[model samples]
Target: MKGVDLLDLKKIVVFLPGRLLPADCRETKFHVSATVGFIHIVAAHDYLGILDKLRVPDDVRLYFEYRELVLPQLREAGVVVEEPDIMVAFLSEMDLPEPGSIEKLRAFVQDVGGFDLSYIMRDLQSHIVNPERSTDYYRIMEEFARVPRSIWREFKRRLVVSLEASKAGTPRRPFRFAFPMTDCTFMVASMDPDWPVIGEDGIRMRTNAVELFTQAAKYDLKTRIGVGLLISKVGDHFLLDWCLIDEPWSANAKLEDLLSTPLFGPARERVVDSYHFRGDNAEPGT
Candidate 1:
């Protein structure tokens, strides 16, 4: 029988489970779509490729939502748009913590007020920099679900998965796809030949999709895409500093465009890109 062999380690895709997505997802600037919020969290943890390999399924009919603003810029020039999010599991490297031995995090948290999240994040990121404390920190996150059990259970789930995943140095967004955007006529794809039973393919799908969009820009596809950061507005301008997917592509000219649009403003709150980058204030556009 011509089937995916269990002996094939190179054929599986490592992916991030949707469960890792927080229930406290914030509102997107201008509410372009779910994608604005999606990009931010994925940008953190270097795209969190939990596994290493995958053989793409024969073909799958996929529906992707890109920043509408960029679609026109890429399509007008006939450039194919693709954003591949992979459910990866076999990374050769992983982001392991440096093993800080301070047992009490209260000291760390106390140094920077939790209420002053920006200060806490910038000064006390070490509190959750490792596997041991990462989940511990989040389970207790003030910003997490009001219910304690919800946060704790989810934290445990993520920790277990993180331990089992392939530890490759996960790459940040902005990679280019070996394949240009193509219309496969929307076919059925294997969840990715790697980790056939898991969500590795899902992670890979996102990674690939991101690459395709970035390439669209190199092709001189001019359009500004705004990845809705967890943080919203501060004063007259929202802190459009932190970039989730190194390259934010969209229909606007800059991040500021969202502010001028019907749905966004500098006074709104900023959303975090997952647990990555705790707090940030306004900065000149990147």
Candidate 2:
């Protein structure tokens, strides 16, 4: 840590995709996290309302500046070894497919305000072990299948607001995964599908991506969600760098629990403070 320059390490920011917890859970909150180099630097939004994209670059730029200012605090806390060279942010949102681009779109709606797949898996596991309910898999499957339709309906409702507003003399911008907030980007890097199988020697090895993709494709069920970083170079230049592309949903554990932690407000506050972000930054009808 003494000789390492924090600026030389990669800075990563993660904006977790918003999702609903199990029906039994009591809270619904959006989540985010950041890492400078290997350090889980101090910090940590249910941001469902509209965001002003015109103000985002400036706001994010200030966030980077504030983090730079606070680098020493993070270092003193021993969370970072060196100053991160690249600054990254991860963001995700529900997006409508581009006209005639259904194949390119991810069709599976994320679980929101309903039963999570995790819950379904648990139920399935219980049924598998309970002989009396082993044959009820189809019923469980049917119940699980309802989540996507629910998610899609919610998204479609949001979409209608955007469309209606646009028709009423207020044009809305398309969202981007990297920027405007989830689908406007032109390039989507492919995801790696290899699973990590623990070997006999106590090491984990990755499954082959090609094989995984091929298998999923056979069922027409191929989609990749990943941990990606939005890297910023000089002023106003940003790039989306995929770190763990095609990571399986099960591999994403921290994201699910992020909002449950105490660090959320402070983390977001530092960034918001940097830009003096106000709810009024959004234009009327935005």
Candidate 3:
């Protein structure tokens, strides 16, 4: 597999495990990235598992309540994780004017030279509402703003111990996937094998179902892929609400079977072969 591209790596770390590492660790070992990946997986699993229990046979209030309760914990975890990465990045990349310079710290936060504390806090705030629309947001923001320096102090202590262990040549385990499996699934689904054609009136229109998979030369090399999209229609426009992409094996066997049915099977074959209908302006049949 290709090494996880830097943009994707940054995207993965930005809110969750990304918040955990120091900014300086951007070039850390793939194993460290893998540990972050595992943390992300575990967090997702915990969130989803709780969501299932709170679902309670379609109680929407419980769902929102769950969100309100859990959002803070996740946000705090991200904030804590981000501090170390920011501290490391700052130490390695920039020159500090003074040991306790408030001006420099303010400039760093404002310019987003490192940690991105403001962005993370804003993102966390966006998920929950005050309902009565009072000063809760400001209060929470104030609470978080007061702690970075202290957080960094403790983090530095831990980092020293970690670095000492590293110097002693501790064996590191390898991770199987370069990027998360979900990332691979989404990337594969986003690949477009065909471009749009222009109509006589000069509007560009799509002519086929978007191709989702490509055949490999060897059978063993072929990837089994499946994706399900939940789309909503509002007025004259269609909006994609959610997407789930995964391998078409075991738990997703039903999805795999759905793709292999006569309707989709022929459409997929036509796409792979670049087959065009007989009529000049023919649209594909449903």
Best prediction by TM-score:
3
* lDDT agreement with native, every candidate: 0.24, 0.27, 0.27
Global Cα RMSD, each model: 26.2, 23.4, 24.4
What TM-score, over all chains together, does every model reach?
Answer: 0.15, 0.17, 0.19
Stronger candidate by TM-score (2 vs 3): 3
Model 3 segments beyond 4 Å from truth? 1-98, 109-238, 248-286
lDDT of 1 at 144: 23
* Clash count per candidate: 67, 13, 10
Can you rank all candidates by TM-score, best first?
Answer: 3, 2, 1
Off by over 4 Å in 1: 1-124, 127-140, 166-286
Model 3 Cα lDDT, one tens digit per residue, 1-286: 1366323222212223356666545332112244443222223433453333222222223233333334345454543222222222232232221233333323222211222234323443332222143344454343333233322223233333333333443322110111122222111111121322234321111111211221110111223432211112223432221112223333345445544543221111111111112231421231
The Cα error of candidate 3 at residue 34, in Å, is: 26
Tens-place lDDT per residue, model 1, 1-286, is 1356333212112235355555333111112235323222222232232111111111110111222233344435654321221111011011211123222111111111111223323423232212243433433232222222222233333322322232322222221111112210010011112322215654344344323333342222222221111111222321111111223344544534423443211222232211111122321111
Worst 10 residues of 2 by lDDT: 267-276
Model 2 per-residue lDDT tens digits across residues 1-286: 2346333432443334335635322221111245323322221221211112212333333334444554544445644321111122111121211123322222222223321223223544332212254434443343223222222233334334433443343433321121112211111112221322235321111223222222222112112432211111222322112122322323324433532443111211111111111233421222
